[model samples]
Structure formats: structure tokens, C-alpha cells
Target: MFVRTATPEDWPAIWPFLHRIVAAGETYTYPRDLGEDRARDIWMLEPPSRTVVATDADGTVLGSAKMNPNHMGPGAHIASASFMVAPEHAGRGVGRALGEHVLEWARSEGYRGMQFNAVVESNTRAVALWRSLGFEVVGTVPEAFDHPAKGFVGLHIMHRYL
Candidate 1:
């Protein structure tokens, strides 16, 4: 698979899985019924921020990630990112590749660290992946997320110094 910076045209391919994942309400903190226009506004970030997609040899988009400053002004040295993988493409290393790519991006862009602001604690796969990639669970807000299957769950705040 190859990872590359995403263009506006990539949204057509990204929207379907993005919609499915967010609507599932099991992982992301986004509103379950989030509409396309709003999702676009959130996911398709502008420059200085970066967005990317992972694709197969045939150019089928398998996953996507967006990285940006965790806060503005004085807090801008810290970075944050979000990822989404196509359900059919899970377990194929697409998420790992995206995660690695984002880290490289953060380092190259001179970020001091990366923080994941709202990782769903029950999403063990993601939690594990982030841990394996050197992120630590700094804290978790008790019952911070309304999970569809698990009812209420914690939201993990993960961090790693670049």
C-alpha cells in the first residue's frame, strides 16, 4: 500500500467509510448522525494542517488520517491527529501505516509531541495500536463517551513526545 497527501477529490472515496465509522458511534467522538457537509468541514482541513490517505496498488483508498496542532498560539507546538480505516480493509496494516506516517509528519514539522484528545477507551485495537506506537494513556475521563454497544465508556487522552 501507498500513503499520500489527500486532495479535495479524495473526499468522494473517503466519505463512505468516514460516514460508516462515525455513525457507528463505537470509536470516534463525532456525533452519530453527523452529516456530510459538517464531516467535510471537520476532516478536510486546510494547510499548515495535513491530511493523507492510504491506498492499495489499484489506488483504492483503505484509510485516512488528518494531523494538526492540538491548540492554537502558545499550544501550537503540540500536534493531534485522527484516523479512519475502511471496515473491509482492517487488519491489513493500513491503520499502522497511517499512524507511522502521521508521526513522521509531526516530527518533520517540528512538533514537540502528539496528543490524542479523545480516543475511546473501549476501542482496544486503537488503544493498543497507539500504545505500540509509543503513546501513553495520560488519563481517561470516566464515562465520557456514549458507546452504542458498550453503553457509556471512558475517553482516553493519549500522548507521546516527538
Candidate 2:
């Protein structure tokens, strides 16, 4: 698989899985009923912030990630990112490829560290992946997320110094 910067045209491919994942209300903190226009505005970030997609040899997009400053001004040195992988492509390393790409982008852009502001604690696969990639759970807000099946769950704040 290959990873590359995403283009506006790529949204067509990204939205389906993005919608499915967010609507599931099991992982992302995004509103479950989030609409297409708003989702596009949030996901398709502008310059300085980076967005990328992981694709197969045939150029089928398997996953996507967006990386940027966790906060503005004085907090710009710290970076944050979000990832979404097609369900059919899960466990195939699509998310890992996107994770590595985001870290490399952050480092190359001179970020001091990467912070994940709202990782759903119940998403064990993601929590494990982030931990394996060197992120630590610095803190977890107790019962911060409203999971569909798990009722209320924690939101993990993960970080890794570059």
C-alpha cells in the first residue's frame, strides 16, 4: 500500500467510511448524525495542516488521517491527528500506515510532540495501536464518551514526544 497527501477529489471515496465510522458512535467523538457538508469541512483541512490517505496498488483508498496543531499560537508546537480506516480494510495495517505517516509529518514539520485529545477508551484496537506507536495515556476523562453499546466510557488523552 502507498500513502499520499489527499486531494479535494478524494472526499468522494473518504466520506462513505468516514460516515460509517462516525455514525457508529463507538470510536470517534464526532456527532453520530453528522451531515456530509459539515464532515467535509472538518476533514478536508487547509494548508499547514495536513491530510493524507492510504491506498492499495489499485489506488483504492483504505484509510485517511489529518494532522495539525493541537491548539493555536503558543500551543502550535504540539501536534494532533485523527484517523479513519475502511471497515473492510481493518487489521490490514491501513490504520498503522496512516499513524506512521502522521508521526513522520509531525516530526518533519518540527512538532515537539503529538497529542490525541479524544481517543475513545473503549476502542481497544486504536488504543493499542497508539501505545505500540509510543503514545502513552497521560490522562483519561472518566465517562467522557457516550458509546453506543458500552454506555458511557472514558476518553483517553494520549501523547508522544517526537
Candidate 3:
């Protein structure tokens, strides 16, 4: 699989899985009932910020990621990113590809570091993936995420300097 800049044309392919993941209320901080339009607005960024997709040889989108400044003004030097892999496409290295792509983008863009503000602690796969990509848990807010199956869980603040 390869990663590329995402386009509006890619949203349809992205939405179904995005909807499923957000609705599951397991990993992401997004509301379980988040609307498509809102999700689109939150995921599709512009200018200095970017969104990308990982697709197969046939151009089927397996997963996607969005990257941007961790904060505005004084904090803009730090980057932030989010990722989602279709459940059907899990365990195929899509997430790793996307993570590597985002990190490369951050480095090329001169970011000081990449920080994830709300990684659900119970999402071990994601936590592990981020760790494998060189991120460390800087902190965790206890019972910050209301998980559907795991009750209240910590929201990890993970970081990796570019």
C-alpha cells in the first residue's frame, strides 16, 4: 500500500469506516453520535494542515490520517495527528504506513514535535502502534474517556519529537 494526499473524492470511501469507528465510542474522543458533516469538517483540513490516505494496488482506501498544528500561535511548531483504519482492513499495516507518513510530513514541515492529546489508554493496539513509532506517554488524564465497553478510562497524552 501507498500513502497520498486525500481529496474530496476520497471522503465517501473514508466516511463509512470513520462513521463506524466513531460510533463504536471505543478509541476516539469524538462523540458516538457525531454527524457526517461535522466529522468531515474535523477531518479534512487545509493549507499547512493535511490529510492523507493509504490505498492498495487497486486504489481501495484502507485507512486515513489527518495532520495539523497541535496548537495555534506559539504552539504551532508542535504537530498533532489522528488516524483511522477500516475494521475490515485492520492488521494489514495500514495504520503503521499512515503513522510513518504523518511523521515524515511533520519532519519535512519543520515541526518541533508531534503530540496526540487524547489517545484512549485502553486502545492498546493504537497505543502500541504509536509507541512503536517512537511516541511516549507524557501524561494521562484519569477517567477522561467514556468508553462503551471499558467504562471510564484514561486519555493519554502521547508525544514524539520530530
Candidate 4:
């Protein structure tokens, strides 16, 4: 798979998977019914932050990730990221490629660490993946996320030093 920086033109291809991921209301904290325009704004970040896509050998977009500073000013050295893979392509390693690419990008961009602010505890696949990538569950807020099937679940704050 090839990972490349995404352009505005890439959103059309990215939207399908992005919409599915957010609409699930099981992982990310984004509103379950988040509109296209709002989702576009958040996904297509500017300058200092970046978005990237993972493409197959045939150049099909399998997944995407967005990386940016975890906070502002003094806290800016730490990076944060979000990922979304097409449901049809799940378990095909698209997400792992995007995750590895984002980690390398953050380190090369001078970030000292990485943090995920609200990882849903019920998303076991993501939690395990992040752990394998060296992130730890720094803290978790009780009943911070409302999982559609699981009712309320913890929202984990995961972290890792670069």
C-alpha cells in the first residue's frame, strides 16, 4: 500500500468510509449524525495539520488518517490523530498502514509524543492496535461515551512518547 498526503480532491473518495465510521457512533466522539460539510472541515485540516490516504496497488483509497497538534502553545509538541477505513476493507491492514504512516509523519515533524483524547473503550480493535503501536491507556473517563449497543462506556485518553 502507498500512503500519500491527501488533497481536497481526495475527499470525494474518502467521504463514504468517513461517513460510515462517524455514523456508527461506536468509536469516535463525532456526532452520530454529523453532516458532510462539518465532517469535511474537520477532516481536511490546514497547513500545520495534515491528512493522508492509504491507497492499494491499484491506487484505490482504502483508508485515511488526519494528524495535528494535540493542543496549543506549550502543549503543541504532542500530536494527535484519527483514522477511518472503508468498512468493506476492514481487517485488510489499511488502518495499520495509515497508523504507521501517521506515526512516522508526526515524529519527522518534530512531535515529542502522541495522544488520543477520546478513544472509546468498546472499540477493542482500535485499542489493541494502538497498544501494539506503543500507546498506553493513560487515563479513561467513566461513562464518557455512549455506545449504541453497549450503552455507556469509558472514553480512553491514550498516550505514547515518540
Q: Model 1: how large is the Cα RMSD against the reference?
A: 0.5
Please give the lDDT score for candidate 4: 0.93
Residue 112, candidate 4: alpha-carbon lDDT = 98
lDDT of 4 by residue, 38-80 (tens): 9999999998999999999898999999999999999999999
Instruction: Kindly list the per-residue Cα lDDT of model 1 for residues 1-162, writing each as its tens digit.
Output: 999999999999999999999988899988899999999999999999989999999999999999999999999999999999999999999999999999999999999999999999999999999999999999999999999889999999999999
Residue 78 error for model 3, in Å? 0.3
Q: Which candidate order results from sorting by lDDT in descending order?
A: 1, 3, 2, 4
**Cα shift from native, residue 22, model 1 (Å):** 0.7
- What lDDT does the true structure give each of the candidates? 0.97, 0.96, 0.96, 0.93
Model 3 bad stretches (over 4 Å): none
Superposed model 4: Cα runs more than 4 Å off: none
C-alpha RMSD by candidate, in order = 0.5, 0.5, 0.5, 0.7
Would you list the clashing residue pairs of candidate 4?
none
Clash count for each candidate, listed in order shown: 0, 0, 0, 0
